[model samples]
Target: MERIVCLLIFIIFNVVAQDEFIFWAELSNKNFILHHQNETISMAMTKSKNKTLEYACEITYVQNDFKEKMYDDFGVIAEEKMTKLDKFNFLNIHKNDLIDCFFNSKIDVKDFVKSEQTYVQSETYVRILPLRFVVEFHDNSAFIYYLK
Candidate 1:
């Protein structure tokens, strides 16, 4: 019974550590899209009135995609998609610092990216719950990671 209890504790600790690692690893990636509950968060940066850059953690969704033919003579089309789904913004002054801190950690960023790609390529959706996130990828032929 004592051995069993120790095993359970180890499992719990490892699970918690993995969750924390995923959270930080995703944030460190430049093209990270995270969904928690019913909202999605993506990093965006803009210049403030003083011209100093300000960063935003906001929610956004893709509404539609518009494709226009660049030239009638050729088969090239320029595509553009835009959507805004910000219910609220959390302005963190040290967001970059937080991301940088992860880079300095022992977590392997390349492994994280590779693992994410494998999930994205899977036919079925992947869920990392308790955080309650659904990693739904589109276009299986090309690994595109998007969350819903």
Candidate 2:
């Protein structure tokens, strides 16, 4: 009976592992941050402007806090944050320079948020706007986006 139970457990573990492996392996690599998230890292990208490479990252683990407000205000919008990031520190770095910084430096979740909320959880985002400079080489189109 014990042997049978152990076999069942092993089968269950194998199935779960296979599902996880498939989920991560099948994701698109067009975006680096998303690609990393699949490897057990949590991150998100925000809007970028034309010819600019700067993107915003969400550091909080709390999802969907502003959903109702977004739908009521903008009509069925996606994730929106009540917090506004300080532009002075992050934006002082130019788009191209920022991308270089992200590649070289290790990012922390606190780097993106304005407040310290213990229960809210946290995430990190690496700005990928500088990638736009290389997009033409990859045959990519210009995309405009605004995060809610």
Candidate 3:
């Protein structure tokens, strides 16, 4: 009986700790590309409840040679022409309560690029709560940011 109660408590804790919404996207995939010229990626989210929540967010760019490795390993082909990434930026919709989360997300690859000569690609996993969200990369690196 004691063990059963402990197990039930553990299950409830795990469920409460998990994010309400989780999204995954391969940034290099054409489906996620919003503007080829701008090198933008976008993902859509939906929720049944209509509630507005204010939050903050943090964007981090890690420099690495993962781009070349990603293309080689995943067979992702790069175009002959590439956009020069000058600055990294992130955008999401929070003003509209109808939108549960990010409507048209955009992420630039400038700060994330290791060098000018290397290509850039990323796989992102996003976990969203009512007041906060976390973006995690394939490398196990993550950033905790709040959204408004």
Candidate 4:
């Protein structure tokens, strides 16, 4: 009985592993983010409720509650973008420059809120906005975003 159970388990595990490997291994090839203009797009790939990988892309310039919202917003949107990410890809935007935008999307917020009730959750302070910056969050997760 033990041997039979072990054999079944091994077979099931192998199948599951193969599926997961295929899913992840093909990500680089099939991911929409890979083909997008890296300079203007920022993507966050995360696992979904269905145990599938999902991604959210941000243009990075719009809705960034920065110091000067009006001027920046005008310059970015007039250029006709889904979101304002003009400044995020600036070559002059050094690592020291302070800029912020939510790297994760609204769907992520909704999912978080569903999990922990007390307060609404959001993907705030994702340090990957400025694109030129690399951040090591308190959770020891290091994120380096490339825009260009």
lDDT of 3 by residue, 1-148 (tens): 9999999876665445332233323223232443222112222133224434433233333454234533333454232211112111212221222123343443233222233456555333232212334332233322333233
Instruction: Report, for every candidate in turn, its global Cα lDDT versus the true structure.
Output: 0.27, 0.28, 0.32, 0.28
Residue pairs whose backbone atoms clash in candidate 1: none
Residue 43 lDDT in candidate 2: 18
Q: What is the TM-score of each candidate against the true structure?
A: 0.17, 0.16, 0.24, 0.18
Q: Where is model 3 more than 4 Å wrong at Cα?
A: 20-55, 59-143
lDDT string, candidate 4, 18-95, tens digits:
211110011111112332112233322221133423322222332333334323333432222212233334212422
lDDT string, candidate 2, 17-105, tens digits: 22111001112222224344322211112222343333332222123323343333445332222212212112222333323334432
Candidates 1 and 4: which is better by lDDT?
A: 4
Top-TM-score candidate index: 3
Q: Which residue pairs overlap in candidate 3's backbone?
A: 55-147, 55-148, 56-146
Candidate 4, residue 8: how far the Cα is off, in Å: 1.1
User: What are the clashing pairs of model 4?
Assistant: 61-84, 61-85, 62-84
Model 2, C-alpha of 38: deviation from truth (Å): 25
lDDT of 1 at 107: 38
TM-score of 2: 0.16
How many times do residue backbones clash in model 3?
A: 3
Tens digits of per-residue lDDT, candidate 1, 1-148, equal: 9999999876666444321112232322223533321212333222113222222122222322122322133432211111111111211222243343323333332323334644542122232221111111122110112111
